[model samples]
Target: MNQDTTMHPRDLLRQMFLAAVEAAQPARGVPPYLPPAPKGRLVVVGAGKASAAMAQAVEKNWPGPLEGLVVTRYGYAVPCAHVEIVEAAHPLPDAAGLAAAERILERVSGLTADDTVLCLISGGGSALLPLPLPGVTLGDKQAVNRALLKSGATISEINCVRRHLSAIKGGRLAAACYPAKVLTLLISDVPGDNPCDIASGPTVADPTTCADALAIVRRYEIELPQSLREILESGRGESIKPEDPRLAACTTRIIATPRMALEAAAEVAAKAGVTPYILGDAIEGEARDVGKVMAGIALHVVQHGQPFATPCVLLSGGETSVTVRGNGRGGRNVEFLLSLGVVLDGAPRIHAMAGDTDGVDGLEEVAGALLAPDTLARAWAKGIKPMDALQNNDGHGFFGALNDAVITGPTLTNVNDFRAIVILDPARD
Candidate 1:
C-alpha cells in the first residue's frame, strides 16, 4: 500500500501499527519456519492467543496428513478443518483450558521416535495451558495469576511462577511426548524472545527452578493457596530441567518476534519519506515511566537532532508493565500514550501511537489510542484532566472521550506491544 501524503499523522501512525501487526500474522510468519513432514503420524497441539491461527497456518502449508488440537483465548480462534480449535480464557485460566491441556497431554503420550509432535506456542500460552500439578487446584493457579498480574511483577517473573505450578508447562509437555520428535514453532511476545519463557516453554526445556519461582512469589509478596505453597516448598512442581533426558528429542524455533514487527513498521515509515529510528525492540519498564523516557528522546530529536534529524519516526516494541493502582480501565499501551501526551504537552508537529500487537490492550477490546499535538488541548476542552486520568490509569477512558482510540479487533497474532512517535519538521508542513 502506497503512503498517502495527505493522510493525517494519526492515520499514518495507525497504518504503521497495522503494518507491524500484519507482519506477525501466523499465515505469514509460520509457514517459512515449519519443519519437514515427519516419518510417522503428525500430531499437532499448542496453547496461546495465536495457537488457533498458527494451527490453521500449519494445516494450509503442510503437505502430509495432520491432526491436532490447539487452545486459544476466547474469540481468538480461526477456523481450521484439520486441527481442532478450542477456545479458552487468556491472562487467566479456566476449566476449559484445564480440560484442553489434559486432552493435549493424552494426545502426545504414546508417540514413537518417528512421529512428529508440532507444538504451536506464543504469548498467553501460560494462562491458556493451566493444568495444575497433582496437588494444586485450578483455583490455586488462578489466584496466583491474579496476584502476579496485580503485583507489578514482570512477565518473566509471572511465567516463572506459572512454570512451576503447571503440570504441562516448562517442558513437561515435551517430556510427555517421550521419544516423539517435538518441533515447537513460536511467535514470541516476550521482550527477549526467549523460547523458554514463551508460553512457559511447554515444548522446550526450562532452565529455571522451583526455587526461582518461590523467590519471585516472595519478592512480589503474592499470597498463594496452601496447596501451591506446599508444592513449591517441597519442590514437587519443579519443571523439566534443561538437561532432562525426556526433552532430548524436542526442538524450538521462533518464526515471529517483536523485532520483526518493529522492522515492518520502520519500513512503513521509510516509505512515507520519514527516517525511522528503531530505539529498541526489547524495551521494558513501567508504562508511564517508559513513556516519559520516550518523550525525552522525542524532544531531543526535535530540538538537538542528536539522535537523528526531524521528519522521522521513533519506533519501539516490548511488553511494558502496568501496576494498577486505580479503578479505571487499564491498558499498558494507552497508559504509555496518555503519559506521553502529558509529557509532550501540546508540542507542535508531534504525534504518536501505542498498541498491543494482538489488538487487545489490557482487559479492553480497544487495541490502544493515538496522541496528537492537540491531544491535551482536546482533553482540556472536554474538561478531562490528563493527570487525573493518568493517575487513575484510565487511558482508555481518556482516549475514548476524545474519540482518539485505535480499535483493531483481534489481529490473530501477537509480537507484544508496538509504539511509534512521529516528529515532523514544522517548516516542511
Candidate 2:
C-alpha cells in the first residue's frame, strides 16, 4: 500500500526525523550504561551539545551524591542540581568553552583509585571543549577551527587535528583521573562510531599521532599559525598513546549511533505502511556529491523498483562536509537537499527530507528543509533560480524563500544528519 496517501509528505518526513532524534536522546541513551556507584566518589564530566542533558540523565539515575561539570552549545543547556552546565559557542570554540575545558580537567584531577569518573561525550565536543595546549591561544584554536570547517575535511580529519591541539582531549582527561576508574558513555555521531573519534576520545586511548594530524592539515591545505605549526612539527602536540599507563582504568561504551537513529526512523516508515530501506548509515562525502549519488538511487527505485520496491522509504544518517564557495548562508543538510532537488528535477511521486538530528544544520539555527517533487516548479513560479542559489551555496535562502525550511531548535541531542526519501506506489494509490 502507498504511504502518505492520507498523510502529507512533509508531515511524514517531520515525524520520521523527530523519531530519529528521540531515539538518540541523552535521557534515553545514558541510563542503561551508567556504571555502579564508586566506593569513594562519583565525579561526572562531559562536553558536547548533548552533554548537559547527559549530565542531567546521570543526576536523575545515580542514587548517590555526585558533582561535576559539562559544557554544551549556548542554547542547548539543561539545568541540573549538582553538575554545573556551562554554555558555549559551537562550530567554533569560544573563551567560555576554553574555561569550561579547564574546569573539566580540574574536576577529574586528584582522584583516587577508589573513585569513579563518569564521562559523557557526544558530537560537537571538540568545539565545546577547546583547551589549547600550552602556548596555543584560544584565537589560534578558533582560527584553526574556522579553516578546518571550510576545508571540506571529514569530521574524522577535523577531529584528528583537534585532538593533537587539545590539552583535555586525546586521552588527556582520562589520564588526569590517574588511578580512578573511568567509564565514558558516548553517543556516537561520527561515521564509524570509533570511540576515539567521538569527542576526540578524551577518556580513551588515541591511535592517531601528531604526524597523522599534521598530514590532514596539509592534505586540506589548511593554514595553521606558525607557532601552532611548530607544536606539530616539534611533536609536542602528540596525543596520549594507547600504551600509556594512565588510561589503564578507562572504559568506553557507545550508547547510541547514527545507525540506531536511522533504524528508529525506519520504524516510523514501517508503521506508516511504507517499506523502509536503510541506505548505509555511515554515508559520507561532499554534501552535493552525496546528494547526487542518492538521487540516482532514488530515481532507479522509482523507475525500475530493482533494489527496493515502490512505497519504500530510503533512510540514511551520517555527517557530510561542505566546501564553502559563493558564501550563501547554508548548511550541509540544506545543500544536500538543494542538490537532490536539482537532480531530481521535480520527478513525480518522489518526496524527501534531510536534516541534522541535532536541530542545527551548519551555522543556521534551522534544522533543514524538505524537497517536494514540485519544489523547483514552485521556486520558478516565485521567481527563484535554483542554479544561482546552488552556486552561491544558498540552500537556506532558497528553501526559506519557498517557505520550506525545517526548524527544530536545539534538539538537545545529536546523531549527525538524517535523510529520507519516500517513493509512492501509483498502483497502490
Candidate 3:
C-alpha cells in the first residue's frame, strides 16, 4: 500500500466531523447557558441524543439543588448526581419512551412561580418523548414512528405527525408547568433549527396543524392505526398554541445548531488551505438524491472551475431522509455517498464524506460513508451494483463491502448530518 499525500481525504474528513462534534459538546456548551437557580426548587427535564450529557453537565455545574429526569437513546446514558437519566429507543418510539414522557409530564404538572424548569431539547427527542395522546396506544405511536422513519419524511414532517399524537410534545410539556418558569436550552439537529421541530418542540408552541400531519401521512401513504387516522382526520389533537397563557413564562434558546457546526467546519477547511463552499446548512430531501446533486457540483468544480475552483471543499449540514423499501441497513449518509459514487463514475481527484454528526446514521453503528476516486470502479470489480444497492436502501452494505464506512461510535451529540466533497486540482503541468 502506498501513502498518497493529498491529506488522506478520509482523515481530513474525519477531522472535520470530529471538530464539528467537539464544537457542540454538551459538557462544554450546555453548562454556561443554564439558568440561575430559582428562588425555590429547580427541576430539569430533556430528551435527545445529548440529553443525558446535558443533564450530567447541569448536575456538575449547578451550585443549587436539582432534581429531575431526562431520556436518551439506548447506550448513550450518562450518570448524573441529581437528575435521573432514562435510556430509550431513538428514530422510533417505544414503551420506555412512553413511560419517560409520562413521568416528564407528571413531574412538571404543579410547579410554583418561584420554581424553575430547565429543559434540554435536541435531536432524537421526538422518539425519546413519545407520549401518546388520550385514546391512543403506545403501539399506535410506535407504528407511526416506524413508518415515518421509512417514508423519507423530512424532520419537520415526521415531527408534525409526532406532535399531533404525543402528549408531552408540541409545547404540552411546557404547558404542564403552568405557573413555573421554564427555560429550555437546545442543541438543534433539524434543518432550520426551529425550536418546535427540535425534539418535537416540547418547550415551544407548534403552529403546525393536524391537517399538515395528515397531509404527510397521505403523501407517504403511511398506514396508521385507526385511532391515529381518526385523530388526524378530525384535527382534534392540537398542540399548545403560541399565545397559550400557560406557556407565557417559557424561555427557549437554541444553544447549538447545524449552521454553527457547518461554520466551524468551514473554518477547518480554510485552515487547511482549501477554499470552503458552504452549500447550505439546512439542505433536506432524500439522501441518495442529495448525493447525486452534490456530485454534479463537485464535477463542475473539478472540470469547469465554476462556482468553486479545485483545492476546495464543499460543506453542507442537515438531516436527510431515506425512504426504505428494502431490508438492508438504512443510513442516509451512506446512501448519499453511494449515490455520489455512481454519479461521479470514479472521477479522479475528487473525494467525498457524509455522516451524521451524532455518529450514528439510521440503525447502523457507522455514522456514514466515504467515497474516493476509485470507489465506483472498486464496486464494479467486486460485482457490486450501485443502483441495485441504492434501490434496496443498502448504503451500509454498499460501503461496508469497500470498507469505507465512517464509524465514530456514539459521538454523544447531534447536529444532524455533515457532508463534504473535496475536489483537488489536476496535477500541475
Candidate 4:
C-alpha cells in the first residue's frame, strides 16, 4: 500500500510507528504456525530477545506435551511454566550465555526421526547463544563481539565471523538433531531476514564458506583468537551447505520481517491522510551518512516538492551501523538523528525520527529520538554542538538535551530500524 492521501502528518507518523510494532508481536504469528506434535517427542529450543515470549506462546497453545529450553537477553525474559527460559548478555557473549548454549546443545542430542524440534530464532540470538569452538573460551568470543559491535560491520558480516567460532551456530545445532524433523520459526531482525543469517542459521543449512567468514573478519579487522584464526584458516568447521541431504527434512519459516513491517507502516500512513514514500527496506551503511542522505531527500520534498510533495512523509526500514569511537552511548537511530539535525540545521517545516523497532537503540533504554524544525538552533543556543556529539558517539545525550529522545522501554519483538521524515507546508506570516 502507498501513503495515506488523507491524514495529518503527526497522525501518519504515529500510525506508522504503531504498524511496525504490531507486525512484530509474538502472538500475531508465532502461535498459529506451529507444526503438529511429534509422534515421539516435541522438543522446543530458541535464542533471541523474543525467545522467552515465543516460548510462552508455544506453551499456551500447544495441544501436546512441550518441553525444552531457550535463552533471551537479560531483562527480556517472560515467564513460562513448561520450558526453562535463561537470560544472558546480548551483542556480547558472557558466561551465562555459554552455559545456556551448552545446555541447548545437550537438549538436541538423542533425537529420533519421530521427534520434532521447534526452533525459535530471532534477533540478538547470535550473542545469546555462544558456545565457542575448541581451544577458544567464552572470553575470546566476548572480545571479538565487543570489537565487531564497535567496528560498524553489517549484521551479515558480523554473523559470518560468529558462525565460525561457535559450536552451536552456523548449522551445527540443526546437525545435532540430524534424524529429527526440525521446524524453525523466525522473527527477522536482519535487513533481508535471510534464514542463514538469523541467529547464525542454527537450524538451517549454511551456504557461506569458511573463507567467506575469514574475509569478513579481515574486512572488519575484527581481532580473533589464535585458535579461532586457525579454525577459519584450516576451513575444517564448514557448516552444512544448501544441498546437504541431512537437512532434507528441515523446514524454515519467516513469520515476520523488515519488509512486512514497513508495509504495515505504509498502510498506516495511507490511513492518516499523508503521502508516504518507501525508499527501500534493505538500506545499509554508517548511520550518520544515511541520515545526511535522508536529510537531503527531505529538504528536496520541502523546497522543490519533486520526488515527493510537501505534506508527504518519507519512510524506510533496515539496520544501520555505527563505528563506535567515543565512550558515550551509540544507538544507530540516535546517531542518525543527531547527524540529520546537523544537516537540517532546523530547516523550517522538516522533522524526522529514527528508531529501533525493538524499542531499544543500541544498548540504551530509549527506542530512538526525534527532531523538529528548531532542533539544531535550540542545541546551538545551549552551547551543545551536534558535530561534537556525533564525534563522541553520544547521540543519546545530544537528543536528550533537546528533550527529543523517544523512550519506549522493551517493545519485545525486533524487525530492525524504523525511520520517518515528516514534511509539511511553511506557515503563513
Top model number, lDDT: 2
lDDT of 1 by residue, 77-104 (tens): 8889889999999777999999999999
Alpha-carbon runs more than 4 Å astray in model 4: 1-14, 427-429
Colliding residue pairs in candidate 3: none
What is candidate 2's lDDT per residue for 339-381, written digit by digit as tens? 9999999998889999999999999999999999999999999
Best by TM-score: 2
Computed on alpha carbons, the lDDT of every model, listed in order, comes to 0.90, 0.91, 0.87, 0.85
Considering lDDT, which of the candidate structures 1 and 3 is the better prediction for this target?
1
User: What's every prediction's RMSD, in angstroms?
Assistant: 1.8, 1.2, 2.2, 2.4
205: Cα error in model 4, Å = 1.2
After superposition, which runs of candidate 1 have C-alpha atoms over 4 Å from their true positions?
1-4
> What order do candidates take by lDDT, descending?
2, 1, 3, 4
Please state the error at residue 33 of candidate 2 in Å.
1.1
Q: Write the per-residue lDDT of candidate 4 for residues 339-418, one digit (tens) a residue.
A: 88888887877777888987889988888887887788888999998899999999999989888888776777888999
**Which candidate model has the greater TM-score, 1 or 4?**
1
Measured with C-alpha atoms, the lDDT of residue 150 in candidate 3 is 84
What C-alpha lDDT, on a 0 to 100 scale, does residue 217 get in candidate 2?
91
Output candidate 2 Cα RMSD: 1.2
TM-score of 3: 0.96
